[model samples]
Every structure is written in C-alpha cells, then in structure tokens.
Target: MPNPSDYIALGSQSEEETEPELEEDSEETEEEQQEEGFIPVMESPRVLAEKESKNGEATVCSNAGESGENSQGNEWNRGDIDGLFCPICMEAWTTTGDHHVCCLPCGHIFGFSCIRKWLQQQGTTKKCPQCNRKCTLKDVRKLFASRVVAIDGESQKRIQSLEAKCISLDKKNAALIKKEAEWKKKEAEWKKREALLQRELHQLKEKTIYLEHLLDVKPRTLGHPPSMGGYCVPSLGSEFNGQGPFILQKELGVDGARLFDIDASSKIILMTRRLQGLGGMHVLTKMSLVAPYTRQDISLPTGSKAVRDLHICPSDGSLSLFASLGKKLSVLSTKINNFILAYDLPAPAWSCSWDLNGSHQIYAGLQNGSLVVFDMRQTARPLEFVNGLTSNPVHTIYSLHNSTLPSGVTAVLSASSAGICQWNFGGSEERQPVVLETGNQGACISLAYCPSSDDIIASFRPRIDNSNEMAYSQHLLTPAIGQGVQGSHVHLKRFGSNCYQKLAVTCANVNDVRLPRSAVMNIESHGCLFASGDELTGELVLQELPSFTVIQHLKLRKQPIYDIKYVHDVDGGLLGCLCDDILQLYGNHALK
Candidate 1:
C-alpha cells in the first residue's frame, strides 16, 4: 500500500528484527530451499512502473497498455539490464519482489534472498559470496530499480588506446612486407651475377691449363734452343766466335740521313740524305766501308722526292732500287751514280724490293696499299698491279723464295698497319693475298726476314685505342727517342705451309717514325742473328735468333737508328747503323 522506497525500508527493518530466529533455523531452511530450487516472487508490472517513474528513470510510452513491451524494448535497446540478474539463481530480479537485487558494502550485487541463504549456510562466519567481504543479512541493501546501467570511463579509454595500437602495428607490418620483397629481388640479381662469374672462371681455368701444356710440349718438339725463363743464357766466353765483341770500325757523321742499304760485294753503303738549301731536294750519299771512309753525294732528278725506302740488288750489288714519295720507283746504277730506270706510279711509293729468285723482277709498295710488280724486260708498264688488304701505307715488302714451299709459288710478303699479308704473283692461277695472323700485336710498323731460317721479325707500335682521344694524341705527338713512352713489341715468327707460327717475343724501343728498319742475318759461325735499334739507349741491340739472347749493345751517338744492315762476306762481317745525324759501322776485331 505504501510507496516502493517505504516498503523496502520496512522490509529491511523487519528482517533485522527476525535475524536471530532465521540464523538458528538457517541450516534446515537452506537444505529445503536447495531441494525445492528457490524461486523469487516477481512484483506486478504496475508496481515496477511506479518505482521507475518515481526514480525519474522510466521511458514515456504512448500507450500505457503496452508498458510491458516498452520496458522489454528499452532493456534490449539500452543493453544495460544484463547485470540485473541474480548470480546464484541466474534469473532477472524484481525491484519490489522477495528476491530483489541487493549489493554488499564492497559493491558485489546478488539477490537479497540468495545472500541471506548463503550467509545463513556459513553460520557465524558470514561473508559476501562474490568478494568474500564479511557481511550478514542486515548488510544486504536492496537496489530499488527495474534496470541497472554502469558507465566506466577508464575502460572506455583503454579500448580506444588498444584500437590505435592495432592500426600502428598494421602499418608497420605492411612496411616490413614491402622491404622483404625488395630484398628478395636484390638477392636474385646477385645470384645471377655469381653464376656468370663462376662460368667465366671455369673457362679461364681450362684455357690456362691448355696454354701450360703447349708451353711444356712446344719447346721440345720445335727443337728450340734452351732458354732460362724466356731469356737467353749465353756461355761464359765470347758470344761471337772468340773474336770478342764487335768494335766500332768507323763513324761517319752525315746530317739529314734518313735510310740506307749496304752493298756487301762493293763494300759500300748508300744512304738517302736531304741536302740543306737545295729546295728540299733529296740525294744519295755513298760511303766506302774501308779505312778513309770517303763520302760522295749524288743528286737525283728534279722531280725525285725524298726516298722512303732503299735496297740494293741482291743478285748484283752495282744496282740499287728505291721508293720515293715523288710517286716514282727508280733504279740507280751505283757504278754510274745515276738513275737508269724509273717507273711512274699511281700513288707515292713507300717501300721497294727486288726478287732474289729472278733478278728481272721488282716490287714497289705504295702509300695507297697497292703492290706494283715490274719486270725489267718490259719498262713501259707494270706486269701486275694489285690492291692490298687495307688502304694504309705498305711500309715493308720482302720477297719470299723458299724451297720448302710448293713449287712455282712466288710470294711477296708485305706489312702495313693492317697487319702482314703474303701476295702470290707467280702462280698459274691468281690468288688473293693471305693474311697471316699475328695475334693482336698492334700495328705492324716494320718487318725483317731471314730467308735461310724461314723466320720473320715484326716490330709493332702499341695499338691506339680510338676511344681515348687524349691517349691517341699523346701517341702521335710523342717523340721517337723518349724514355717513358710505351715502347714497342718485336715478335719472331716462322713461315711454313703458307702460314706464320709465332716463336718468341721481345720488347724494344722501336717507334713509328721514319719506318725504322731492322735486319736478320745468318752467320755460319754465329748461327742466325737479329739486330734492332734501342731508342731508349740510342744503341744497336744484337741478339741471337729465336732465343733472342742479347749478344751485344753497340753504343751509338744517342740517336734513334733509322736503318740497320748486316753484311757477311768471305773477308768478315760488317754491321751498319744509320741515324739522323750519323752512320755507325761496327766490325769484328779482325776486320777492324
């Protein structure tokens, strides 16, 4: 009949007054309640609505008859009535019912009837079922509400912090995945490079082993003279048949001498010289190899320019053949001191040579890489005019007449910057020139041939890499006699079966100026000998053939030798070294 709050206060006061009797009969009542399963008597809906309206917490519904539906809808929508159930009985509690929701001082809530029974079962030691707080039936204060809602501010803040941390962790994970993918790509590239390098290393090892086998077997089969690590080891005594080293017999100082050739039969040397104040006229200076060393200057025709190459007739020493930049190939009779034969050429001639097998045959190399063959029998025109492999000037030409080659094969060996080629002009069928492989040994600037040994010596200038403009310019401007210049290479090769086989190589101070000439001569007492100029010391270096053993270094006047000639006769041997300013003659002591 009274209000819900007044009824709750009156029930609490009566329960406190009857507490002693309830405790004395608590065990028996608890057993009976457990068997029957305690059921709380729920209050009517009108009373609950009245209590909720008085507390100012009830929602206003349009229809009072739908009050029950509105309360259920509110509980479902607010989602705060979940904690309004009794813990022990697991059922919703009523605000004014016998099993009302109540709380201990420690804030644990349970049904009032459930707490009373729970404490009565514990006898004198009554404590809260949820928090173990010491309490009795009087301490259970009822909650006067239809529904309960709690707001925990710290729990809300903790949830927001956890969501932010999840977002940060997701971004970090994405970055880590991207970095792993990039590392995988880099690792694949490195693995590919490693495989390629391994293949190259294996190929190099095979090549090295093959070369080592050749080195061990080749020297034995070729009957090459024994050498100590690519160096000739000479015996203790004199290297030149106990005559001691060659001594300087005579030195003729001549200005403007460019190239020269020796006439062993006549004991004379013919050199090309430019006479000063003669309007750049070039002449032949003749000198005797004997004691007084007399010199005679013979003038050429007005149109005869500076001779680029000079060679005496091998069969007849009285005649000399020379190529001049005046576009003329002329033959001079040393006896008459005049040119008796001259052939007009299409281009400037660079080098000339006479066929040793046929005295009537002559060959001229031109600046335009053309070989002009002439027969003395017909002076009107050349017998054959052929182009070389390249347009570079043919700086050297040598007639090859060896019996070991196929019969009726007359080949002319020529060398230019394009490399060495052998032209066959005396076969039944015309054949193209064969290019002999010299194994990438730069530009072939000069060549020396030994007919008896079937050996050829080629001098090379360091190859100019066109990609490096500065280096190419330096190569062009560098002087021929400088010490620090990248010197040159001299390779010794044997000619057989229409091919050339490289035998040995040596370094020299050869340069690309004036077409310096080197010589290979066969001496019965000294085997074969090779002579070349050493621009570094301005000396003529003499070495034993094939082995390249240094026999002597004849000191000159510290000038680059333009030409070297070795002449051997019944009397003795004579070596001639021609420089820009002087001509040096060295002979054995017997001849000296």
Candidate 2:
C-alpha cells in the first residue's frame, strides 16, 4: 500500500502538496460539495511544526475521515474511489497486511493475497483484476509504504532490520533453482544405466540356456552296414549298373551340377558347367530328360568362366548359372532362339535360387558377404543388394516360401563362415539381418529348407585342429580304410529366430581325402526324404529330414562322388549321382 503522503501528491496532481492548495480543490468540486460539504484534507503546516517540537512519540492524525484514505480532499476511500476492490475476492483493500496493494505492469492495483491465490489456482495463466489482461507473478510489483508516522528511534531501527531480511530470502531462492537442475540431470543418467543392465541380463540368460542344451549327450551314431527295414528309403535299382559313360565324353568335366524337374511338362533338366584353360572358359550343358533313366546333353553359350552354381525354374524352364571367372550371372531359356542374358556381379557368386512366388526374381549370394537380387525381366541391373553375416563369404542360400510370415516381407536365409543369417527385405536399404546361433558349433557349411514343415535345416562342421594331426591321419588311414568310425561328424541344426536347436550329429560315410564340403545334401520334394552323397565310399546316405536318422546306406558309385539329387516323378523317387565325371540314375525297383 502506498503511504498516505504519496496518495496526497497523486490527488493534488503535483510532486509536493500544501494544505491551502488541497482546500481550494475541494471547494471547486460542486458535486462532491453537495454530497458531504467536506472531503479528506492534508495536514496543516502548523500541525507538522507542533509535532516536531514534541518528543518523537507525537502521532500525526487527520480529522476529516476514519475510512482508509489519504488526506488529499480527493476520492481515495472505498465510498469515493472507483474500481478499488479485488474482483477475485469481491473485497476492498481495507486491511494493511492481508489486503496489501499489488501493482501490475498494466498500471492496475489489487489486493496481493487475492491475486496470488487466483494465479495459483489457475496455474497456467493469470489476468489483472481490473483490466483482465494476461499477466504473471514476475510482472507484479508489491507496493510498500515509503514513509510512515514519525516514531521513537528504537521503533525506526526495527523497520530497517526487516527490510534487510527480505533481500537475503531472494538469494536463497536462486540457489534452490540451480540445485534442482543438477539433481534432475543425475536422475536421467541413472535411468539409462538401469536400462542397459536389463538388456545385458537378458542376453546372459539366453546364453545359459544354450549352454545347457549343448551339454546334453551327443546322439548315438549308427555305423557299419546300416539296415533299411521300416523306413520308406529309395535305393539303386537294376536300371543303373553304376557303369555309365563319363559326362561330356570325359573331355571336359563338371565343376558344378544341379537337377531340376520341369513340373509343367513332367520333364527334368540336368545343368552342368566346366571351365577351359588359359582363355578362361565357360561351358554350360543343359541335358533333356527324354526317358525314365536317359538324358541327352545340349550345349549353350559359354560365357567367361565355369559355373559355380546352377538352378532352373520349376514354373518356367529358365536355366540360371553363376560363373567364377568374371563373377557373371547368365540366364538362358529352353528356347534356342532366345538370347542368353548376362549380368555382372560385384563378387564371385557361389549359390543362386529363384523366388518361390514366381515373381521373376532371382537371388544369388556372393563371396563378399553380399546377396544381390535380380529381376529377370530387367536383366541389365540388380534389383537390390543386401548384406550377410559379417564379412564372411556366403556359401549357401535358401528362399523361405512360407505363407506364415507377413506380406511385403520377403525372407531369405544364407549360410557363411560367420553363421546363418536371415534377411527380411522391405523398403529400407540399411536393413539388419537376424543371426541364427546353435550352441558352439563350427562354421555353417550348408543350408536347406523343408517345405512340408516350413523349417530350415543347417549343417555345421565341428571345430577341430587338423593342422598338426595331418601326418598321423595319413598313416592311420591304411588300417582304418574301411572302418566307418571316422572322428569327423556333421552337426545338424534347426534354425529359428536368433537361435537353433541341435537335431543330430552323425558321421558321414567318407574317407580321409573327403571333407564335409565335398559331399552334397538335398531334401526330397515332399521334405520327408533327405539324401547325401559320400564321395569317399561312393555311397548314397539316405536319411529322414530334420531327425536325420539313416534310412539306407546304398553303395552306388565306385569312385569319388561329386553331387547328389532327389527327383519325384511317376516313380516314387529317383536318385541322381554325379561322380568321377559320370552321371548315374537310380530308383526304387518297385517302380520298374
């Protein structure tokens, strides 16, 4: 609240006031004169002189009004002043403490406590009491009396001391605001640390479960002359004598081979390739299946190098091959008049496959940890390039043709030294792949898909140091030549999301010179029958898919085997074996 002397100066319209000037203004206001004949009046000069003459205990008094007002002969009282009451509390600023005047930036004054309470209740925004203009607490100024009645020296000292305390309280408030900011920063860091620990704990739990699974005893391996009694296993029938002429007249041998059945025409296609000497040759041979056990080779355009992988479309008899010399991919249709389309790859492609949904798309995994997909309609450029597991070379690939997954998501599984990884293709270019782990198995060597169960089967080579034992193995081979107890066992795994379950660990029928990479494994059309070639013993190891139980172990070829394939036709199952430059065909004798 402003001092009474300040209000007197405002009403007089001057910096200082005299008793006679205030008396003249009251007489000129004829309207106010008619109402009371006398308004509040300032103190006379004689009264001030008399008060100074007395002790400081002398009190200054005005006799014109008892209401809260200044002695200015002006409308300062509630009865005379207009808009002096607080709009929020509907009360006049009559009390000295609770109803102290607060002035806002808009030059409007109201009771301090009433406006403070109204602003706190609203919280977000506040308005001045008189003008209803937007305002805040910082925009308000608390008015304190600049002068008061003269008192004794001791009373005057007490008022000065109270003013000093208000300054100290303001400093304390600033320090508290800074302290609150520092504490909030620490809280955020602690929350981040807690989240990091939770992720680590989850990963540790997964590893513990995987280690326990590995500790389970290895499955018993079946050895010696395995029997074929209960299982529906196919074998070498009498039609094949294991004495077929070498493919390509033995002049040029095959580096890669694949068998494809043209389901539309009930005919099969046999594709092979061989490389020439210094000139960097590429010879792709397409054989036609005319009879049940006979095929005639038809030559196609040789590109740059030997084909590293060959695949033919089942829906359309389109032959695709990836060569090694220039890292080129070539596509040739069954029609002789069509031109051979070729696309250059950034790296050497080791495996290729066609899309399952007949989208005219082809995918090939390269040696540089990349999978390039090509749209057959546009053979001039690749459609997309995807990364694989780490930087390891991708050796095998299988297209997931299941309808269980969401649409627009094309998934492809590939195997490399780093492990098996699945790529989910969508819109983004920097898409990350999901890694498949199966305990502590060695590098992934092969990947196959089971259409019946929609499961993926993978083969891993057990980690062992053959570097120092090379000499001992060469010498022990003479006595253990026919002994089926080879230490090398192929580990089989079923792949899932970020994990794989061990299915079987069995010893393949092979000799010292043959490794697991040299043998070929394939799943039948129905996914129930699995077949693999044992190059060392020249035998076909037939097993049940996923379970990997040996159904039959039939000795077919006399020399090293190169590849093995299973075909479904009018006959139940026909087995094709590529060995020592020869291609032999066999089937169940029941079909004959």
Candidate 1 local Cα displacement, residue 396, angstroms? 0.5
User: Which parts of model 1 have CA positions greater than 4 angstroms off?
Assistant: 1-245, 405-408, 467-484, 487-490, 493-497, 512-514, 589-592
Cα lDDT of model 2 by residue, 1-592, tens digit: 2222322111111223212211111122333323543222344566456545654223112222333344454455543333344545655542235565556765566677787667556544455544556666555565543222233344558877777777777778878888989889988999888855653453344345433432321121122112221122344322123211111111112333332223224455455534223142334444444522233334444443545556566456655444343577667665662336777888866677777766577788886788988888986688888766466666667677636545565777787755777786655445678776555555455555654445555554443464322222221101223323233234344434234455556555444332222222333332354556553555666665556665566554235554555444564445566655445554443333
Leading candidate by lDDT: 1
TM-score per candidate, in order?
0.56, 0.48
Screening candidate 1 with a backbone cut-off below 3 angstroms (N, C-alpha, C), the clashing residue pairs are none
Output the lDDT of residue 129, model 1.
62
Q: Write the per-residue lDDT of candidate 1 for residues 366-401, one digit (tens) a residue.
A: 988899999988998899899877787888899988
Give the residue spans of candidate 2 off by over 4 A.
Answer: 1-266, 275-281, 291-303, 321-325, 337-339, 427-430, 464-501, 509-527, 588-592
TM-score, candidate 2, is 0.48
Collision pairs in model 2: 40-73
